[model samples]
Target: MLNSCKLQSRNGSKPIVKQASFLTHANILLRCHRQAASRLGRCACIRAKLEQAEVATQKTKDEVVVERVSSTGGSRKAFAKAFTAILGLKLAKPEDLDPETLLNPPFPRYQVPGSDLAVQKLRPYFFNRTYTDTDVGYLAFFAAMHLVAVIGGPLTFSWEALEVCLAGYVLTGMLGISVSYHRQLSHKSFRCVKPLEYFLAYCGALAFEGDPVEWSKMHRWHHMHSDTTADRHSPRDGVWHSHMGWLFDESLNSTRRDANGNMKDSLSPPWFYKESPEFYSWLRATYMYHQIGQAAFFFALGGVPYLVWGFVIRVLLTMHMTWLVNSAVHIWGEQRYVSNDNSRNNWIVGLLVFGDGGFGVKLRIICQCRQHIPRHHNNHHAFEYSAAHGLEWWEIDMSYYFIRGLELLGLAWDVRRPSPSQLVAKRIPPSPSAGASR
Candidate 1:
C-alpha cells in the first residue's frame, strides 16, 4: 500500500510530475477493481513477466521555448511556479516511464522487498498529529540552536571537545545512519552481533530522528516512490519540501509513527529489531534508561553546560546533519556517474558525513561513492530499492566494510553485493585513485 503522508506548498519549485495519474494504473491487481470486487482479497507472491522500454532522443528535433524575464518579475516567477504545478498533477507521457518496467531495473540483482510492487494511487495530503512534551522539548532545543548560530556563533566550547563530539557525531552519521539505520534497520543489508546491534540502535534513538521502524518504512517508501509524488524527499520535488519538509511535518510523522512505531510483528528474521520481541523490549528499556542516565549525569555535573551541550546542542547537531545526507547529497555533489534524477556522490558532505555514512566502505576503497545500497542512486530514482548502489569497481562502501568485518568474525551473514555482471555493464570509467580511503 502506498501511504500518503501529504504535501504542502512553499516558495520552492514544484515537483516535475504532479497529478501522477499514471500511478493509478500500476498494480492493476491492487486497484479499486480488486478492492471493490472482493471484501478481502489475498495477494500472494507469483512470478509475473514485465517489459522494459527506453526512449533515446539524440537529434533533439523538438525544442521547448525559453522565455527570459527579470529575476524579480512577479509574473515571470508566477508563470514558472504555475507551469511546474500543473505538470506535477497532469499525466506524464507513458514514454517517460513504463511503470511495468519498474518490476526490474538496472540493478540486475539484489532488490529490496516491496521494490517491485505496483503503486496504484496517490493521496494529496497526510493527517493530523498529537505531539508530546518530549516533542515540544526537542522543538525548543532546535530553535535555540538555530538562534545561536544566527546570533552568537557556532557555540564553540573548545576545539578538543568539539572535535571529540564531532567524531562522535560522525559515528552517529556513519555507524549510526549507515550501519544501524540505513543498511541494518532499513534494508537488512547484513547481520550483526546482538549486543552490538542493540547498543548501536540505542545510540541512534538518542539521535532522535524517529523510531527506527518508522524511518525504515518511509525510507523504503522513498525508494519505491523516488522522484515522483510518492517520494518523501526528492530534490526533483520542491527543494525545502524534499529537504526537511516532511520530517518536520506533524501529520506525516504522526501517520508514519502510527503504522510502524509499535509494530513488533513486522520483523523479518535475522532482522532482530523487527523480529525479536526481546530485542525490541531491551531497546525500549534502554531508551528509558538513557533518559534517566542523562538526567543523572546532569545531576552529577550540576551545570547548564552539560545539559546544553551534552543534551540539547548535541541532539540538534545530529538531527540536521543526518537530514543533510538526504538533502545535501542530492543537491550539491560531483556525480561520479549519473543514473537518473539528482543524486551525486558529494565529496565534502561525504567527508563531513564521515565517508558517505559508511556506504562507501569496501567500495570506498575503490571510489567511496559506489557500493552498498542506493547503488547508482541516479539509477535508484530510475530504479528504486536497488541493494547495490555501486555498479563499478571504484565506488567505496563503508557500511559494507563493517558488515564484512562482522562476517569474517562469524557474527554476520548474508551480505548482499551487486552481481559481477551489473558492474561490467555500467562500466563507469576507471578512476586512477580507486582504492583510496579517508
Candidate 2:
C-alpha cells in the first residue's frame, strides 16, 4: 500500500500536495534560522565594540590616576630635597628641583624660596617683577575704589542709601556675576536671547569684574587647570593670591596674550564675544566709565549718601563676596564629590553669594521663605557643564532657578545637564558600612 501511495504522489495526488507543503515549510524554517544567526552575529559584534570602548575609557582613567600620583610623588621628593638643602644638610642644586614644585610647595612653610612674596622681597629671586602698564592701572583703580568705600561709607549714611545698596547687590551680584558671567558666559550652560544676554552682561560690567570675555576666559582656565599650577585663583597659591592678588599678576595676562596683544586662540573668547566682538570690546574699553557714570548718577540722586552706599559700599561688598567664592569656598566646606580640586559646598559662602544653604531647620525655613537657590560648588567642579549645580533637593541653586525662569519664559534655551545615568556613573560609591546602614 505505501508503494502504491508513493507512485500516486509522483502522479500528482493528495500525497504529492502534502509532501510539497512539508518541503516549503522546511525551507522557510531554514531561512528564519539564517536570519536569526545573522542578527546574533551583528549583536555580538556590537557588544565587542562596546566592551573595547569601555576598556579604553577605563584605561584612560587609570592613566590619569597614575600621572597624578607620579606628579605628586615627584613634587614631594623635590620638596624634601629642597628642605634638606635649605638646612645645609644636603647640596641639592636649585635647578634639579622642579620649578613649579619650588614655587608651589606641597606643604606650607615660611620663606618658600620661589614664592610670589619671596620673589618680591628676597634678593635676586624675581620671576616677573616688571609690572605692565595695565597692571599699574588696575592696581591704582582698585586702590582708589577701596579707599573711597572704606572712608566714605561711614561718613555718609542714610536708609535710602542702604536700600539702594541692597538692590544693586542683588542685581549685580546674583544676576550679573553668578548667572551671566559664571554660568552663561564661562560655561555656556544655557543660552538666552541676544538682547537679554547683552543686558545681563551690562549688569555684570557694573559688578566691576572683568568684561565678559576676559572674565570667562580666566574662569575657563581655572576650571581647566583647577588647583594645578595653571589655576589663576586656586587656594593652593595662598588665600589672598586666589582672592585678589591674581588681579595684579600681569604675567597671567602676558601668557594669555599673543605677540600682537590679541587673546590667544587657545584661550578662546566666550560665545557672546564671538557673536558680537565689537560690543564686548567696547565694554572692555569703557567698563570703568560705566562705573563712573553709575557713581555720578547715585551722587545726583541723593548726594554723598547715595554715592557712598549705592556705588562705593555696594561695589566693595560685591567684590569681596565674589572673591570669597575663589578663596573661602575652596578653603572650607564639605566635599560631596571627588572633583580633583579643593572645591567645597560652603554654606556661609553659598548663603552670601548664591543663596545656597545646608541641612538645618533655620536654613530650610530661610530657603523656603526667600526661595534662595544655592550653588553646590563641589557639584559644579564635578560636572562643569551642568547648568544646575545643585544635585540634591536641599542644594538650592538660585542661579539655576533664574536660568530655569528664563527657559520657561522662552528667553533661554539649550540648557544643559547631566543625565541621571551619567550622574550615577560619576558619583562616588558609598563605603560598605554606609551602604549597609542605608
Candidate 3:
C-alpha cells in the first residue's frame, strides 16, 4: 500500500560517534572549510565597504582580493556540467549559484536589451512543469482524504474522539514530523537510539508525506538548493508550486525551464524507499501493514469516531501545517539570522508546529496569549546541526526542549549546536544589518 514516491539518503557525517568513519570526518572538515570560507568572504565584504568609504576621503585604487570558491571535486565536474546544461543554464555547477553572487552577481539577472516591453526582464522563477501519474495519484489521494476529514470528521466528532485526535496530532506532528523527520533525519541535529529512531520514523511515515527517507532527501535537497532555480519548493518558483505543485514533480532530476518555458537541463533523479538499504529498511518492510495496523487499532478503540478524527483529521491538518512551512513561513515571517535563503522564523508557525510547552512562559505573559513560540527555522537553514534554534532564552523552541530531554534521559546523545564563532561569522553587521534583516 506504500506509494511509489522514491527515497534516498546520502551518507552523512555522524556527529555523535567518537571514532567516526573517514568519510564522516572528511565531511566535517569540508563543512569547517566552508564556514571558514564564508567568514573570509564576510571579511572581504567588510573590506570592500571600507574601501568604498575611503574613496570619499582620499581617492585611491587598492583592489581588495576576494576569494572565489574553488570548483567542486574533479570527476564530478563533468557530471555537474552536464547536469547544468540540462537545467538549461550555462553554469558549470550548482555552487555557481551561491549567495556570494548576491554581492558580485556571478550569475547576473538577465536584462532585455532595450526591448520596449513593459516588463524588461523576467525573474528566474521556474514555471515549466508536467503533471505525471504521480501527480494525479497524489491529488486524488489528498482530495479524498480531505473530503473525508471535512465531512465525515465533524459528523462523527465526540469529546472522546477529540482527545484521540489531539494525541494523534502531537504524535504525528511533533514526534513524527518535527522530531523524526526534521531534527533527526533531515538536519541530523541529534542522534538517538536506533530503535527509538526507527519508531519515530515509523510515526512520521504515518503522516503520509512520503517515507522518512524520501522526506529527508527532499528536505536536504531543499537546503542544498534553497531559493535557487533548482530549489523544488522555493516561493520564487511561485507560491502555489512551493505549497503543493512541486509535490507532483518527485523526479528532482528534471531540467529547469527558460523564461519562455523551454526545458533547459535534466535534473538528477529520485530513489525508491529501498534505495536506502540500511536506515529505512524497516519502514519499507512494513510500510503498508504497519499503517493498516495503526488504523485498525484506532478503530478498535473508538470505532468510527476514532478512525475519522485520529486518521483523517490528523492527516489533513498535518499536511497543511507542513505545507505552510514552505509557503506561509517564507512569505510572512521575519528573518533573525542573515541566511542566504529567504527562510524565516515564523512565530505563529513555530507555535503550531511545536507548542510553547512552558518554555516561552514570558513571551506568553507579555503577548497576553498562548502562542508566540520562537522557532529559528532560519538558523536551521544556516546551521543544520544546531539543536538550539533561538539566539536567546526568550526565543523558545519546544522541539529543542524535547531533544534535550531525550538527551538527558539517555535516549539521545551528541546534540550538535553551532559554536559562538560560527554564529558570529553568520551575524549581520550593524551597518548593513537592516538590509540583511529583510
**For every candidate structure, what is the RMSD over all alpha carbons to the true structure, in angstroms?**
26.3, 13.8, 25.0
Q: Pick the candidate with the highest lDDT.
A: 2
Error of 3 at 422 (Å): 2.3
Candidate 2 lDDT: 0.69
Instruction: Summarize candidate 2's per-residue lDDT along 1-438 as a digit string, tens digits.
Output: 898888877676776789999999999999999999999999999999999999878865543332210122223223334444454553312222334644554544443233322211111122425543334555666788789888888788778889999999989998998888888888988999988988998999898775676678778877777766566566666666777877665455334333344332345446676578677766766665677789899889999899889988898899999888887677766666678877776767777776432221234465444322334777788888878877766666777889999999999999998888877877766568655653
lDDT of 1 by residue, 77-182 (tens): 2333444455453322212233343333332232223232222221122233333332333344456767754443345454544554565565665677756777
C-alpha TM-score for every candidate: 0.53, 0.65, 0.61
Candidate 3 C-alpha lDDT tens digits along 1-438: 123222212222234254466678899999999999999999999999998888744522211111011122322223334444554654212222233432243233332232211111112223443333434445556677888888998799899888888888888888899888887777777888878887888889887665665567677667767776656666655566667766555343244433454321221212322234465654544555556677888889889889889888877788888888886666655555677877776677767777311123446667664433455667667777676666556777777888899999999997998888888888655447545643
lDDT of 3 at 15: 40
- Best first by lDDT, ranked: 2, 3, 1
Error of 2 at 276 (Å): 2.4
In order, what lDDT does every prediction score? Answer: 0.48, 0.69, 0.62
Which parts of model 3 have CA positions greater than 4 angstroms off?
Answer: 1-130, 249-253, 256-279, 355-375, 429-438
Off by over 4 Å in 2: 1-131, 252-265, 355-375, 430-438
Q: Rank the models by TM-score, top first.
A: 2, 3, 1
- lDDT value, candidate 1, whole model: 0.48
Better of 1 and 2 by lDDT: 2
